[model samples]
Target: MVSKNQIKRITGLHQKKFRNEQQLFIAEGIKVIQELYNSSFEIQEFYSTDSSLQLNNKVKPDIISETDLKKISCLKTPNTCLAVFKIAPSKPIKYEGLTLVLDDIRDPGNLGTIIRLCDWFGIEQLICSEETADLYNPKVIQATMGSIARVNVVYTSLERFLKNTKQPIYGAFMDGDVVYETELPTTAVLVMGNEANGVTATVEALIQKKISIPRFGKLQKTESLNVATATAILLSEFRKNLSGK
Candidate 1:
């Protein structure tokens, strides 16, 4: 059983401010917890209703009741287990073959899907504008489906980073030339903008190439593609070129 203070502290991690203050975040479900356990993230605490669950970490989990787990869980239907892990220190951004730059992507699901896409396509780094969804947001972690453990995600100033990098920058836009027709470089920065507004003017100025996913529907009334789905198609296109297809 967990003490009232402990429950309060663990629940606090659901908020970004508290997560930052505690330098800790929560991962729920067996898969997410297992992935974090296998990764470099240091597990600070583990709480589970199942007493037999095995963990490789040196810290033995507090075997709590399902009632106790619910007190600290943010999920509507709490999973069987939840683990708290210390946030790993950010590594220096590696300017490599292809980097993903997100300009204020505010949706947690979109950010999580993008991270998974980066991992699938072998993109080494992901750069997000400071306003982008928190990397540790519970919904984002759940959406990543363990891909969060592999991808390197960082938040920084979009303008400053763009100004400093010499790599060719590409931005996805509704009016730009069809993506299938664009001459994509193997090594460059791909910028994905916010869901509703697309790219901001400041960041757009830094984009060397403007590209778009062509719509084939006769009505052509679809306002735009969901950012995550667009990311999947764009990354697939980028990987094809990298593989010399």
Candidate 2:
């Protein structure tokens, strides 16, 4: 049974401020918790409804009643288990090849999907503006489907990072050169803008190349492509050209 204090602490992890202060975050569902366990992330505590469920000797979970489990869960229908993990120390940001730069991506789902895409396309480094969604947000964690374990995410000043980088910089834009025709470099930075505002003028000024995924459908119909979808298409084009397969 989870103590009252423990329940409070776990639920508080749903917020970014609490997560930062505690330096811990909770991941729900068997798959997310299990995938995190398999990765380098350190598990602090594990709680599950199923007594038979086991991760290892090191991670012996507190088997609790479903009622108790529900108290700490952020999901409407909590999964079989929830685990609190110590946030892994940020890995060094390697700006070597195909780095993804996010300019204030505020949506958790979009951020999560983009993380998955990065893992899929083998993009190693992802830099986000300070205003982007928190990596540790439970919703984002759930959306990532465990890709959070693999992708390296860092939040900092996008303008400063872009100004200092020597690699060719590319930003996704509505009225930019066609991505297909533009020759993309293997070692470069790709900037994805905010959902509503697109790239800020500050960051846009630093972009050496502006590329866009052209629309094939009706003209002037869709306002914009979802950031996550655009990321998938853009990353696909980058890898295709780089691999030449």
Candidate 3:
């Protein structure tokens, strides 16, 4: 039983401009909402078709009909629940451990998957170029599953960040040193480029080292690996040697 005003507000969050204006973003499904609720992100509105669904037994959600839920859901088949959360304040970037950087990654799904990959490898800090997709984009949020709650993402100037950092910067390139053989530093910055363009020349110039995943197939015809897939493989290689230590 959502009011017309509430419906407009919630659906408006689907756009980046409206989301920024409202200082809020939407998350759907029990897992995503629950993970966010348990994290530092503050929940503004919670609506679900299931009254039995609970969030850590802390706050009860408003029960809404499925029709009303669909009115605001970004997904085609709406989940049983949706929650609007206040966009958490950006935290300071900690450069101690392996830091992941993105150079103009425009796809929301790619950005979200990369965030999840960062969470998987325990990479705490993710730096994105200002051109990267919005972290709070609903597609990105949905793709993150629940890992968005864990990773700290910041959007800034890639060139400035690279120039200012004392870390050994590495960029993923199709034509570069083999990643598998390269000795990765425990403390470094790894830059992944756009899906179509790879790393921008400006940022690529700042990379202290360039690494690539070698193609093993006989044809070697594949143009490139998907950015998120490349990220997972590279992160795995970076953390592989240090796993047990």
- Most TM-score-accurate candidate: 3
lDDT of 3 by residue, 1-245 (tens): 79999999999999999999989999999999988888899999999999999888878889999999999999999999999999987898776889999999999999999999999999999999999999999999999988898898998998888888899999999988999889998889999999999998889889989999999989988888999999999999999989879
User: Hey, what RMSD does candidate 3 come out at?
Assistant: 1.0
Tens digits of lDDT, candidate 1, 1-245: 78999999999999999999989999998778888888888888889898767676444567998889999998999998899999887778887789999999999988988998998999879999999999999999899887887888888999998998989999899988899988888889999999999999999999999899999999999999999999899888878965755
Provide TM-scores for the models: 0.96, 0.96, 0.97
RMSD of each: 1.4, 1.3, 1.0
Between candidates 2 and 3, the one scoring higher on TM-score is 3
lDDT of 2 at 21: 97
The per-residue C-alpha lDDT of model 2 at residue 135 equals: 96
Give the 10-residue window scoring lowest on summed lDDT in candidate 3. Answer: 88-97
Q: Candidate 2: list runs displaced more than 4 Å.
A: 56-58
Q: Write down the worst ten-residue block by lDDT for model 1.
A: 52-61
Q: In terms of lDDT, which candidate is stronger, 1 or 3? A: 3
RMSD of 1: 1.4
